[model samples]
Target: MSGTERGGGSTVDAVRAWRGLAETSVLLDGFHALKHALRFGARVPVALTSDKAAVLALAEDLAPDVTRPLETLLAETDEATLRALVPRLHPTSVAALAVRPSRAAQLETLARLPRTAPVVVLDEPRNLGNAGAVIRLAAGFGATGVVTTGTLDPWHPTVVRGGAGLHFATAVERVDADRLPPGPLFALDAEGEDIRALKLPDDAVLAFGSERSGLSEGLRARAEHLVSLPMRPQVSSYNLATSVGMTLFHWASTSGRPPGTGA
Candidate 1:
């Protein structure tokens, strides 16, 4: 089960049903969530849990002024009504609640952003867990945004589950390659040029290959360059999410920018 962080402490006064994403978010990565929530300077308005002790502890950790007690936590139970509440809280602090369709389309809307910005595009990867993990890592690495082409769905349950609370913190767009902003595109490939040797631009699209098949022909043709991770002969390549994270980290390190500072 998972849940989102809903804004408005006043909303907490009334015991409205909370969606699962928020409930599960509390458990996704305790240390990471706590750190991110604090890093972004978020006030945890409610800590709804079945157990009183856990609520108290979370309140103490997050800040006593904002914590709201609830009768139950949504993640532990499979209640349909509670689950349905997710879409209703669209654009709320709970990042996973409902993604605006306009926001979804903007991922490929080139006019809104610069061509050289650090963008991540995943193509038909098919695995929500990988996508969600990539979202978290993308935020950690200071990506300007995330865009998915083909059939990859960012709102899929598994991906949302993997993202924890990270989905709320960053801009994620889903679109096709044609919709992507104009720029120097680089696809991650095992046989491509060494990433370490390439003169990576401060702003460019880093297209991660599909988890199973690597880059699609459409993406391959669209990319201006191909990059590869360094590895011993035994290991063919890195995990889809791992490769994206490592590449983003390398870009950040070489650019002399701190992690998570989006250009």
Candidate 2:
């Protein structure tokens, strides 16, 4: 019998649950993805692995803290079974499903005032990978959220795959340009003021134009400050993800770090 139909509703129970929830749930693709998601408090309903010993070894080597919980959660199944469940198997050979946060909860978090970190705004972003990379950066830098003002779903499966399941670490959502959170809007533009001269505020909305065509007229009009990164004379613009990394690093250097963190 298939692992999905064996035992006293053992792994089969969990596997069946995963199958039922897969369409609506968030897929945690690999070992690292599952690890990060669990660490960040994602509500994972089920996890399956081909080799529990190997995954546990990985846990022991990299994340000793989660080993006990993983022991209770990981359901051991054969390779064929795992391959049948997940479309493309991860190199580490592990997969899981977690609950996606509600739009209402994300909206509420984004709208809350007295914000400590900046909210990253991707104005009409076209690339899914770029948006995912931006979300990963935002999470690493402790940005309040990563908001996209465009048709691209920031939480698409491809983007989620690119993000390595770090979406649970921060707020990510899509909304119209006019509905962005309350903060000082600092939009990045080629003709704007030099970024080095100013100290970005804690509650700033650090906005970046899309990969192509730059910001829309409506978004540009909403910008309180137009900031520019230092680029050579001939260069037109940096890659969208690279630009966000540079800008976020600047924010971390100025406000996110402790007074003597590196020293």
Candidate 3:
């Protein structure tokens, strides 16, 4: 597992010969790539590098297990060769699947989940950190998955780091508003009905909008119910993630729903 460098296409061949989805994904060239891989806890199956010294040095320091020495990993390479190398590269046991979805559609995906102990969706959310942190939080709260609309790539290096390893375990689907699965949709809005007083349905799709605009007109219209979290009159509004977390917690406490149970 230490600084052992195997030479030639054999190392590349060894990586390419791997059968299952890479238990780990390793990125070459930049720090962001490395950061994302590390954040997801993906095993560094092999290191592809132009700088042999640098590659060996990196292997010595960071990834002791994966050290496949290859020339094709250098900066200048063709797609055919890269494609050939990809299968061989092993991803970690828990792979971080990434997606970049549009604003409206991501919202729609959120609008589709079952209300009973389901996933969280953020529609047309602009903040990258909020989107990433929310995905991470959703995983932490034991939500089934996360849907994002109008935001950065959840698997983007920065977002992955923000997720703090939560992204790998969660199903993040990027979809359009029109494609949302049919269900009881609810929106969290200040003007909505009191969450405590309202009778929450057995199954629901809870959708939250951005901080400034709140839920969109179309989203507001689609919701079967509009729910609001009780708060101090002096407080203006909760952060998007905070609001969603509150609603999730509220449902968890009130619904008597078991974890991973669906509507």
Candidate 4:
């Protein structure tokens, strides 16, 4: 873990393997992204680093839990090699390629009954950064997973970057409004019930709309209950990410034990 002359294969072999898998694999763009992904059980086939010693040191100091795997998984390479692998180099200069989770597996998890925490729904979200942020928040609060009903791929590179590789922590997938799993659908809207008054159930399907249009008519129709965040006065709406944060925070606080407290 100290030098630039470690890891399984030759630099050329490693680079070739990376290039071959680059299009299909999930790119862990930085040290933290790689760290989180590894901690959460991402199958990292190849990892590249310009500075192994420093990266391991950072891991040891900040995330000691992942230090050993980082030492094992990281393949030291030249700056040019690392740069060529990724579009823009992160400040930490560490990158890796991890296998994406099986969509069928994620769908099965989502479809399971007696869910312990809410599944956050992003109805036709437009922004990648917002989707990533919401996914990260869902992971933080121990929500079951994030389901997006729209054209946006929740696992897109930009969204994954924003999520900081925490997608491995929870189920993430896309489905139509009608295909959403069985649950009491509670859609978030401006003119709905005040969130403070209701106790968000552990098994709720909490849905939030896009930043631009709010909840869509189809989503609204699918919703069994429509809830709202408290607004002061003239403010039209909150940013999609922040709105999700507030709603999940409400769920966690009123949840009595935790977001995913077991029976």
lDDT of each: 0.60, 0.85, 0.55, 0.87
Clashing pairs counted in every model: 13, 0, 14, 0
User: Could you tell me which 10 consecutive residues in candidate 2 have the lowest summed lDDT?
Assistant: 1-10
Give one digit per residue, the lDDT tens place, for model 2 in 1-263. 11122223378887788789899988889888888887888888788999989999999999987787688788888899899999699989999888889999998888877877788999999999898889888888888888998799998887888888889988999998899998899999999999999899878998898888898988888899999999999999999989998998888888847421321
- Better-scoring candidate (lDDT), 1 or 3: 1
- Mind giving the per-residue lDDT tens digits that candidate 4 earns over 137-232? 998899889999989999899999999999999999999878887789999988899999999888899999888888889889889899999998
Report lDDT (Cα) of residue 84, candidate 2: 94
Worst 10 residues of 4 by lDDT: 1-10
What tens-digit string does per-residue lDDT give for candidate 1 at 1-263? 11134433333331343343355322222323433443343344333222335534555576554343222221222223323443332211122123223563445443355533477889778788899899888777767667888887775656655775565566676776687755679988877899999767766888987888888888888788989899989987788888988888888878876876545
| Candidate 3, 96-167: lDDT as tens digits | 222223445534544544444555667777777787778767766556567665654555545555565566
Give each prediction's root-mean-square deviation over alpha carbons: 6.9, 4.3, 9.5, 3.0
Task: Give the Å error, residue 70, model 4.
Answer: 1.0
State which candidate has the highest lDDT: 4
Question: Where is model 1 more than 4 Å wrong at Cα?
Answer: 1-48, 62-111, 115-117
Q: Cα miss at 17, model 1 (Å)?
A: 4.9
